[model samples]
Target: MMTIVVSVLFARSTRSTFPSDGSTSSLITHYLAGAAIASGVIVTPPAVLALTTYVLAPSLRHLFERLLLYPLFGAAALVFLFLAVTTWKPGPGTPTSNMDTAASLVNAAAASALATSGIIVTTTGILASNFWLTLYFDARRCHPYDHIVLFLLGTAAHIRRERHRWHDDNQVTIWRASLEVVAVQVERDAPLSGRTGLAEGSAYMELRQEARRIAAVIRSHKRDLAEAYSAHDVDAVVASLVVGLRAFCVGDRTALLAHAPAEVAPRVGRFARTALRLIPATVLIVAGILLPLVPSIAHSELASNLRWYLIVMGTITFITTREDLATKIGEAVAKVLLK
Candidate 1:
């Protein structure tokens, strides 16, 4: 039941062209039903249930595209299940603490093996089912090759170690530590629990009161609190926030310059500087876009020569502009201030 639910959910969430046309949902439902029926039929069970399901599903009789897709979807579900199991971590109270690292390594290796096998099985099942030729050109509508490339990319990413940072801790430890430090003050101000059966409600009231007291204390020591937070830590936090805001405000000249609309001359100067720097690459890109319209010009020997010329000019422009921009920016800043 868990397997079926997870497979259905994954199939639904995946990006497929058929989903927009409402065929993917039907295909997945029928495929899983077929797999379940086949599982009951074979006394010993086949080596690949996905292959069996693809072969047995009568709904897939006329739908050659579904015949190819169902097996791939099944294989993907198996891979996702394997990954989930392998990466799952036990709670803090769970046993096997000493072997946790070793166990993780083993699980990762096994999951990689399973993923590779799943891909192989999917490919083999498609070929053995004799749907490859039918799917080759006809399946272009579904972009199967793009999906395969994406799957390979996902698998590659999964095999790599995940990157984590201290900032990713969600600040839980910091909150816990703060509570612990103020526990004595909290107890002095309010009872930890009420008498009789009113413990839950009383505890909630005490927590609210304690939070108010903590907030007041923080407000009173705002200056000291500011000083206590190191310059580096404050800068790091500010920098992180600025990075996100900067990305959002990118290309918004008014937000970036913070000057009045009357400053048209400086804006024009900036534009001229930028356009001069980008001329080589911009010309090449424009030529590439326009060349196809004129067959005579496109086929001329000059056209072939321009490709190498563009490359050389682009390289020189990049190097010179990179070096020139810093000097030009300084001069612009001086001119603005002196004005």
Candidate 2:
């Protein structure tokens, strides 16, 4: 079952992603090549495990194991989440520790993939052994329905990208330009414009132009962040925070910011803030998941918490990513009051 699903996904991903690179840069081509190679390389062992394990195993008293050791995974995840949530400044052991952490993460991830592959293989084996199935041929659940869901989802995504190409560009630019708008919008967030009474191409060109307009702001913010951090001034730090947070509230896909609540979106201060904060936190959060599985201090509880945190933050970021400035401010205000 897992074999079939993975194969289908690979095939679909390949078909959808690797378009002809007649006009693309060599860098893009190389990147895609690397990606394709990595995916195939990663899938090979799991494919082998699923084929062998399921074929050999016949019966077991229990299908799945839920031991105390599993919760260990959850604990690791929670610790990492806390680190990721709170990381703000840089310090010693931060660099070398980070290196060691990354390497361990890679090893753990590889092992995890191997374990999952083996499980899928075992599950299929049990099902086949109990139901009576051949070795070469395998049966799976709802191949058609799964494919249908994939198709529908893919089609919808395609339509959306096409419909909002300009809008998407606008969004990408707006996010990139968040630092630029900080000072301007501290008093009032930008207003959303209705469709400009212009031709389609003209509108898109103007959209791109607006994106260009924010470029200087982005650069200026970057410089300001550097200067503030170098000076180690609280005022600069606060100013940087103000500017960076302002970006999160800048725009949704259509030049609209998230207007829900500030607690909902505690904006990081700047790229410096992000580096000092988000990255370390992300590393810890990831480490929390990756570390506990190893021989040292693996905990299942941490892993479970990490998974939930990812889901929660993933949903929040996805929803607010495209909101405009006013909405973000409104939400930010909401956050301040709520807290």
Could you tell me which 10 consecutive residues in candidate 2 have the lowest summed lDDT?
58-67
lDDT per residue (tens digit) for residues 1-339 in model 2: 456535533433332222233323433444455344444444454454444433332111011122111222333233323322332232444576454443333333333333343333445445545544432232243221222223223322332343333334443343223333332232121211223433566775544344333332333443443333232332443343433333433433232122212122223333333245445446545654565566534454444454444443434443343447435654664454433
Which residue ranges in model 1 land beyond 4 Å of their true spot? 1-69, 72-74, 77-86, 105-118, 121-132, 135-339
> What lDDT does candidate 2 reach at residue 267?
33
Compare the candidates by TM-score and give the number of the best one. Answer: 2
> How many collisions per candidate?
0, 46
lDDT of each: 0.40, 0.37
Supply the global lDDT for candidate 2.
0.37
- TM-score computed on alpha carbons, candidate 1: 0.18
Distance (Å) between predicted and true CA of 174, model 2? Answer: 21
Indicate which candidate wins on lDDT.
Answer: 1
